[model samples]
Target: MKLVIVMLGLCCYSALASAGDNSKGKELFQTNCAACHGEHGEGKHGVAPRLAGDASRWSLKLFERAVLSGVDDNGRKLKLMMPHWQNGSFKGDNGNAPSKEEIAAIHQYLKHPR
Candidate 1:
């Protein structure tokens, strides 16, 4: 029984560590991405592609690359408008770059926007 409990606790902790916080994601998106991606990630016409469900097929690594390096899944460079966020170009939240956890949260929100 103790072994089982320990296993269950580890599983729960792992799940929590992997999952991103939806609320934090929404806030970060609104503060940093909404201007270009739209309030609900609907995207602006002639500016940015719609983000809602756009990354449904993307792995987290690919998403991270695109966000942090401006490289698409095809290994091609994204448009110039896409900021390489790793450079800390974003002006939101005291102009600091988004952490990995924060990026994951944004991905979660984009994956399942409410």
Candidate 2:
């Protein structure tokens, strides 16, 4: 039981350690999502739609479905040219599975812009 607790604790720490912050997310967005989505998510990538101000209109459901499944709620295809990062995320020198908490963070960031 003690060993189990220790292992679980370590897992939690590792997750938090790799957990993405927005600065990291923005950087990731630039390199991975920006080409198609545009740097500020402003869209106009010829294939991609404008991303800025898009999330405010969407429920998290819409957002998640689009990100994970590569399809929008309206059943239109989206950014198929890009890789999926639904179950996880990658940034910088490391790749990791983003926890639900992390996804929520990214969602919130997108939903509200500066």
Candidate 3:
């Protein structure tokens, strides 16, 4: 009984840790990405591709590479308009690039935009 309880507790904790915060993601997207990606990631035609369903197929590592290194899932360079967040070239309102956790949150929000 004790072992079962401990296992259950571990599972709950793992779930909580893996879940991303969508609300915070929405706020971050609005501040940093909405300008280019649109309010709901509808995206501009010639400027940027729609992010809504496009990113759903990407793995977290691919998403991170695209955001931090301007590299696409195919390992090709993305458009010049895509900012490399890790290089500090594109600062948010807080004057800093988004952290990995924040990026994960943004991904979660993009995966299922409300």
Instruction: List the candidates ranked by lDDT, beginning with the highest.
Output: 1, 3, 2
Off by over 4 Å in 3: 1-21, 89-93
lDDT (CA) per prediction: 0.81, 0.63, 0.80
RMSD values for the candidates in order, in angstroms, are 3.3, 7.4, 3.4
Better of 2 and 3 by lDDT: 3
Candidate that would win on lDDT: 1
Estimate candidate 3's alpha-carbon lDDT, on a 0 to 1 scale.
0.80
lDDT tens per residue, model 1, 56-111: 34888888898999998899999979888998744556777768878778888888
Query: What's the residue-level lDDT of 93 in candidate 2?
Result: 30
- Residue-level lDDT tens digits of model 2 in 57-102: 6787777667776777687876657456764465553666545554
Clashes of 2: 0
Clashing pairs in 1: none
Which 10 consecutive positions of candidate 1 have the poorest summed lDDT? 89-98
